[model samples]
Target: MRQTKIVVTSVEDDNFCKCRFCDKKIAEIKNDIMVPSAEECYKNGNVPVPNFGWFCSQACAVNYETKFDINFAKTKEGKIDYYL
Candidate 1:
């Protein structure tokens, strides 16, 4: 017989929340509404990520995605574009 150990971490335990785009603390609510959820972090993103993603707006989400992936919002001016 064998025994295995596993560990899990989540952002829900954190005392402070931040904006995924600018890394700013989300201490204020806008018009009584909170920030966007993790599932809406990226442009075409539809899955929940575990790293506490709370974007203030859609533009912030896009900006954050662009920073993570340089080509996330690049144009196909002089590069080969492919669709699959």
Candidate 2:
């Protein structure tokens, strides 16, 4: 089983860490959380896993891992249209 890494940072200037996958801003109040260790994932002969940063929602996290479009749409001209 693969574990997810979630880094909790202090909210400064009303801004939390942005979602690594979707690039969405995650704003929240500072609180206690239990962060899991990734040492097991890096054990002997284990394949490297990409560290996905903070996420605004679970949907965004899933979309990011699956490479699906959620916050943006692609145009016929191959330009990315952001919905922000």
Per-prediction CA RMSD (Å): 12.0, 12.1
Tell me the tens digit of each residue's lDDT in model 1 across 1-84: 333221212353344445566665643334433344222222232212233345445456566666787333223452211111
CA lDDT, every model vs. true structure = 0.39, 0.38
Most accurate candidate by TM-score: 1
What does candidate 2's lDDT look like per residue over 1-84, in tens digits?
Answer: 665443333333443445556554443233432212223212321122133334445445456656865433444653332211
CA lDDT for candidate 2: 0.38
Cα-based lDDT at residue 49, candidate 2: 19
Instruction: Name the lDDT value of residue 53 in candidate 2.
Output: 35
Give per-model TM-scores: 0.36, 0.32
In candidate 1, position 43 carries an lDDT of 27
